[model samples]
Target: MTALAVRQIGPPRLTKGLESAGRLDWDAHRALHPHPRPLTTDQLIALCEAGSLHGRGGAAFPFARKVKATADSAVRRRKRTVVVVNGTEGEPGSAKDKTLLRGAPHLILDGAALAATALGSLEIIVAVTDPDAAASVQRAIAERGLGARARVVRLPERFITGEGGALVRGINGGRPIPPGRKSRASTRGVDGLPTLLSNAETYAQLAVLAGLGPHRYRKVGLPQEPGTVLLTVTGSARFPAVVETAAGAPLGHLLDLCGSRAGEGVLVGGYHGAWLKGEVATRTQVSRAGLAAAGGALGAGIVMPLGRGTCPLGECARVARYLAAESAGQCGPCRLGLPDLAGALTALASGQDAAAARDTVARAARMVTGRGACAHPDGTARFVLSAMDAFEDDIARHVADGGCGRPVLGVLPAATDARLSLEVDWSRCDGHGLCADVLRGTVRMDEYDYPVIPSEPIPARLEADARRAVAACPGLALRLVPRTAHDKPRPEPQRGR
Candidate 1:
């Protein structure tokens, strides 16, 4: 993680070039920050509107829109607003946020401060879980003596903890899971005051643009807007690193940097992303516009490797379960639906009935969707459902012949990781039937038996039932497995019958 000198500049930033992705310490951002008057909210909005800067965070929601939403607030008496820098990088496959937060903390801070100034905020919190990232940001804060106005907050290590809203919850000492309902962090956030939350890179980009102004910023990228974007190229790369390329840099140019050695197909945007069979150089453009052309998103700008060695269906099943378990469990569709959806994938991956699997998937999609409070459930469902569509051929093979030719490589996270294990304390088992009633997909009553448990993963629609199983467990044998890498399923003496 040492910073190596890349060629020239000002503030030190990290980049994964085609040649080398190692940390480089070139001073591209060391120039004096011009002490321009803090732009009025309208001026800031114009700067964003002129620059055409998409959200550096995956969502690409216009920064101008978020600013307009929060900055234009009409609350009679406003609570002191806080601006949150989300650096969780929760997606296991994405590393862009961590890279920016670790290497260019000051640039991010400068941008956040600019935003805070615009929003009438006095406090800025740079939140992250990665050790190196946290330390880097903290040191930058201390070195600049910006500690009073800007601070760094270390967070509990977990995947779901990175969700935008979840990160807000983490900051306030609440559980880091997303809530059952959607509330804009910019509206009702951080100590019940309207907070402006954005990914770390968004701030960095804002800083860069603030320093350069809209005209200079528009020089490099498309005329539709102007500016560059940073992306983390992973999967199969000769020398993968963070890249500072033109906004909507053609994937071809980036792939050229990758050269011949890249995994066949790719997963764009990270874990909460989509998988496709293609490369960047020839077919697709890399801009939000470009990615949209490819029917994909430039989410968090993670270019993951979809190596050919893994079975696509098995891979889908694996990640599906992880995504399901990663749910904040606040929304009904995501909590109940994801598990069921993931289960269907597991069943298909293991050679279950194809027709039944398809029907079950369709049903799960219908039941758990639109019922969630957050987009997590909806996004997870979209990912799984799209995967099924994307790799229908492999899925058919899993059903008709019981397997895809490729081995189930660990490219995707485990599908059954936390979902299959139903830990009910025998002593606590009152046989009250709540767990069974709630999670019939997992547990059921058998003749003279406490509960019949299925060893397989649950469906997405049944996620609520799983939670209810945990909540309703009379003996409190049921417990939720928080979303974390260490959550391994427990082994059992008796197997599912």
Candidate 2:
């Protein structure tokens, strides 16, 4: 694990006044952000509502509303509530969660305790993927004498494993995938109890908000979205960092602070976020509303600036392929459509019939939109579709001359293949035609009416259809199988030293 390096480009808020420092151990963290006035459940809710605090996760859900739902539900049902700190940063383009966990573990823990105490429960579960971060939390738990009341759970590194439902499922001793149906963790989660779940940054922000209250918290950020936000700025920047900036700070200013050059386009939010260029990127602020106003978002506080000299289409294709492979493989559209989009983009980037490739990618994106168990399909589509607009000129030149004359610099991050595949259980098969019918583009019927599946990875657009087919199949023959197929066999060991 890399050493946690953190700084505040602007004045620090959620960063506990740290401007240029490395990881803050529990002592350092407690010293910086000391425990302050504790709020009751209603008081905490009122403070969040007044400050208009939203989740720092990609969704940016309102913190007060979620807490209220959980608290109200628990009070009514007479059930013990739970507070889950989601430190699983699955987005390839993000390091803010890990940074927060490693740099200032106590801030998140304080927030977790604050939230848990407010919800009338002492149980706190922190789900984290990074071992280093998890260890930090565990150390802090012991130091604080939290014992079993607060625990750190090590999670898998899969892309969608950070999802709330998936985290709950894993905690409940099931595979870390979202349930087939739409189920909110706030109502039924963590052993069938009312749960309050949010990302690491959300908890840290809550801690900051709890200590500072509304009026003082309003000193830095926008009137609507007040307080500083932590952003992970990477890609083409001179110095990559998890920066803390005021909510309404200009996007251009943040880029400049990170030493980003002019002519570099930005992918705001994250992989599931939008790309922005020209005046839009410069004028847009860091707030959720501000980014949304500029056809972008502040999702999970991730900012990636694309260098001017790189092939934008190539970068898009690389990310698209990575996203395709990252699919949960439970939905038809995500399973089939993403690969199509990636292939089409790759073809276009490689100077193959650019016009046709563009059309195909666009159509594939449309087909997959809003057709997944989660927002993965829709978010992936948004990411790819927006690239077309942000790089329109490049598309024209590539289409006309079969190239842009620039090499792909691999500016965006791509995940290593997990060697995951879809599998069929013959014993569970009853010659059901539903898989083939729904996944018409991916699955075909065999001579005996059983599915004839391909060996290659399924396209993402077919994710929804696949999920439907699986759900509809009475025999439950189809399943998404993840394997260590990408791992190379170990070589024989050399003589010991």
Provide the TM-score for each candidate, comma-separated: 0.78, 0.83
Q: Please report how far candidate 1 places residue 77 from its true position, in Å.
A: 2.7
Q: Which regions in candidate 2 have their CA more than 4 angstroms from the true location?
A: 1-4, 17-20, 262-264, 417-497
Worst 10 residues of 2 by lDDT: 488-497
Deviation of model 1 at 25, angstroms: 8.8
Candidate 2, residues 1-497: lDDT per residue as tens digits?
A: 24435667566767764555556766777777869577798998998998888999989889999999999889888899999999989887788888778767888888889988878775999999899889888988888899889998887786778888888998888888777579988889999999999999999988888787788888888888888888998888887878888878888898888888535368988888998875578888888989898898888788888887677887887788777767777878766777677777776776666778889889999989988888888888999998889888888888888778776766676654334456789999988678766755345554356775544444443455556777888887788765465633222111111
Error of 1 at 279 (Å): 7.4
lDDT of 1 by residue, 1-497 (tens): 22222221112222322124332232333543443357777888898888876676778888998887776552534566888998877776666677666666667777888888888886898888888888878877776677688888888766677777788888989888876566888777887777888888888778778887888777777898476666767555555656667665567666556542334556666665665555442477777777766656778787755555666766766677667766666656765677678777666665655567777877887787677776676667667776676677666676677666566646544343233345556776767777766653345454355665554355443556677778767678666444445544332221111
lDDT of each: 0.66, 0.79
